[model samples]
Target: MTKKTPSLISSEFFEPAKASEQVAPKETALEIVARLEKSLVGRNPANQQSPRPPTRVQIPLWSEDHRPVLHDLVRSALFTCGQRDARMDLKAKPIYALEHIKITYTGEELRQRDYDVYLQILHLSRGATVDNRQEWVEFEARSLIKMLGWTQNSRSLVELRETIRRLTACALEVTRSRTKSSVPVVYGGPLLLKYAGAQEGGFDEVTFWKVQINSEVAAQLKPGDYTRIDWQIRTKLSPLEKWLHAFYSTNQHPYPMKVETIHKLCGSRMAEIKFFRRAIKAALDRLTEVGFLSSWQLDDTDKVKVVRSQMLTIQDRESNNDVRT
Candidate 1:
């Protein structure tokens, strides 16, 4: 019982081309070779065109004096208050505020990275052609990743998204003192109005994101008060170092600040004063090593004395100091 294999085609008579049959044009060897080459390179020979050069991505440069414009509180630890992971809901009486200003962060405690994200947003916003009513800005994820000197990876993208979310979720109740009356005017708003990313895909698929700065927050970004930070040096420093740099950069002539004052300003949750002092000392040492600070030392009273580099001063903006660390 041998089984027969089924035939794929029916037996039929095939006719050769007749003399009257339309003859097809034959391609020359060169034409055939050219077509083959085109096909191999993923081009249609029929519609072949000259190849274009790779596009040059223009990255905006950081102006020597261009600083991130941030509200004093935002620049400080009011929003990033407490431990890196602690959820905070703080009410504090700032010197400028007539009444206690409430600050809250329910999710992961806002950290130095979150503040960096905010500053980066401001940096990007400054470059954009913004109108008076322009409350929102759209940025390509790739552009931001490149600007921040971050590795193009899923983890970085996820962290970026989370940082934006934290900014949008955090809220502040700012109290402004009125000259005419003793009444305190309270202004409350989220750091960001909205944040949106690609819905149906991964980080690679998400091309851009849109973020809206809250009106109140936007108002505080006026030119005169903004401090221009050296982001190149900033990105290289530790969290505490970066914060101290920002804090001191705002002042024209930085005075000797107490470690306790700095600890409070940094919103550190270190339970022991000794630990906080050590952290501050380490940060200052790094700053000094980086040339951002000329020199720094602790006095007998435990107050930290810091000498600002000419680069950190607006008076001598042209001075180029070596920031090695």
Candidate 2:
């Protein structure tokens, strides 16, 4: 008897109506993770990761004469331990007075590695949250280690600090590690004012986290350091990509500009610029489909008109600068 081989089903065989089902959905869990991860890193993860919600934090509450250092530290701890994870999943509600904030995996039969990875994230988060605190700091470290199956009381402030350092760095590293398995796309910078284009509610979730995290972390720092962290967060873009994309999107370079220009203008690492491009292009495509901004090849006169309008804007800016001088 001859063995049989499986043949592929080509699109030619599918009806027009059925083509949509064949196409993969745009939004996915990975996309959510990627977006949040970018926002966290850009927003100063160390500062933004807070325990309490923003609606509750009070700012300028500290008087110049007596700045409460421990309060600042508490604010940072709460924000780091709570806020970043809090905003993503509306289903995840706050439950207080619990010893360990246990994150259970119940939806699917996820691999042990998945649990371990996320557990590591939580462990490191706890370590950072309790950084420099004499009370409950060791306990937080121990609980975090327990979750990771690493049991030994040898953890020191130095060790905890190292853990915090590694964990924050790992957030970026681990993100890259996972990206290899998925389709690679450009990441537009953080959804800041400039790059928002037609995308509404861009960075609202991130901005919400930043504002709340800053106020909370402000309460937890070591006097001078507390102010430094909070102030930096207020001034800097969390992901940095949002500002870069805003720059590119504002300039109507027909078709995407040379990828290198994007990398240079945005000051993004190679991998990040790649993703930024994908995000911008994806957003543009989406906008075009919805009849927001029309995207077309340079061959068309209408497309040339768009480019000309962009050029005029640049010239106007230059002219304004000359006039000011």
Candidate 3:
């Protein structure tokens, strides 16, 4: 026996529309076609309202001489301390933190030096917009190297160029680890939108090379949201020391953090936690030497305690040493 295929209108259903009950079958078909045509026309790229151009994202010119580091960047390990090859995972990785200073990163491993390079780029772009569209900043890379107090020789120039390339290619996202707070800003952007330079000149030509900051990043640059650090002091710091400075700069009232958490915070690649402790000790000492920290020590609880230069150092006399690495 042959089987019948199922249909939208079953044979077992009620009677069809009578002559008087006719729903104007041909007109109904026409109406359906018209409705479908309307829908397809509505979806057609040309028929719908032209998409509004992306609104001009113009941030005010930041006129400070000090380097403006965003809290989003300063508090997290988006830029790592160690020279280890940090993974290129596109998924956001949770950065270890205390209280609610949680941050997550999504990008290639950014080094400590990348932070400096990016900040310098930000510095250059500070004068770029209030009405600027391109957001391009011009500089001869040799001068930029010297501005950062880096050597201005040929080799160093090439290294700086490569650094710019790396930063331009890499993107990152920094968001609060928790949403309990009223903070609404979450930053996500590449270090640069794009850059133009000659391989031979290394941005040292008469037509100087230029770099553009992504508008998304620049839109967040405003007063009261960024920390201004002394560029001279930053230039003197090592990779790990630089990371330490930024961390402390963001925390006005410093609290003792676990050595292990800090290890994860800076994205340290030290195979052993003990090695990170030693490096951290040396880094804190450097910070003290540079006057960013008045003093820092590990307590018996294995948490790092730090006193800033402005804060009075309350020396703890009862150090029965449990945090010594």
lDDT comparison, 1 vs 2, better candidate: 1
Clashing pairs in 3: 102-177
lDDT order of candidates, top first? 3, 1, 2
The window of 10 residues in a row where model 3 has the poorest summed lDDT is: 316-325
Model 1 collision count: 1
lDDT of 3 by residue, 1-325 (tens): 9998878886645677677876753567888899998999878868776766664564544445467676666666677786656455545676654444556655566787878888887787665552225746779877787788887577777667767777777766655433475765566667787888755653433224788777776676655445566677889998888888877775555778888888877778788999888999998998888888888889998899988784321211121111111
- The runs of at least 3 residues in candidate 3 whose Cα sits more than 4 Å from the true structure, single-residue gaps closed, are 1-65, 84-107, 130-132, 177-184, 201-207, 310-325
Count of clashing residue pairs in every prediction: 1, 34, 1
TM-score of each: 0.65, 0.18, 0.71
Those runs of model 2 whose alpha carbons end farther than 4 Å from true positions after fitting are 1-241, 248-256, 270-277, 286-292, 296-325
Against the true structure, candidate 2 reaches a TM-score of 0.18
Using alpha carbons, what is the TM-score of model 1?
0.65
Residue-wise lDDT of candidate 2 within 157-227, one digit each (tens)?
A: 23333333332222110011112466532211111111111112322211101000122232222322222
TM-score of 3: 0.71
The lDDT of model 1 is 0.63
Error of 3 at 255 (Å): 1.7
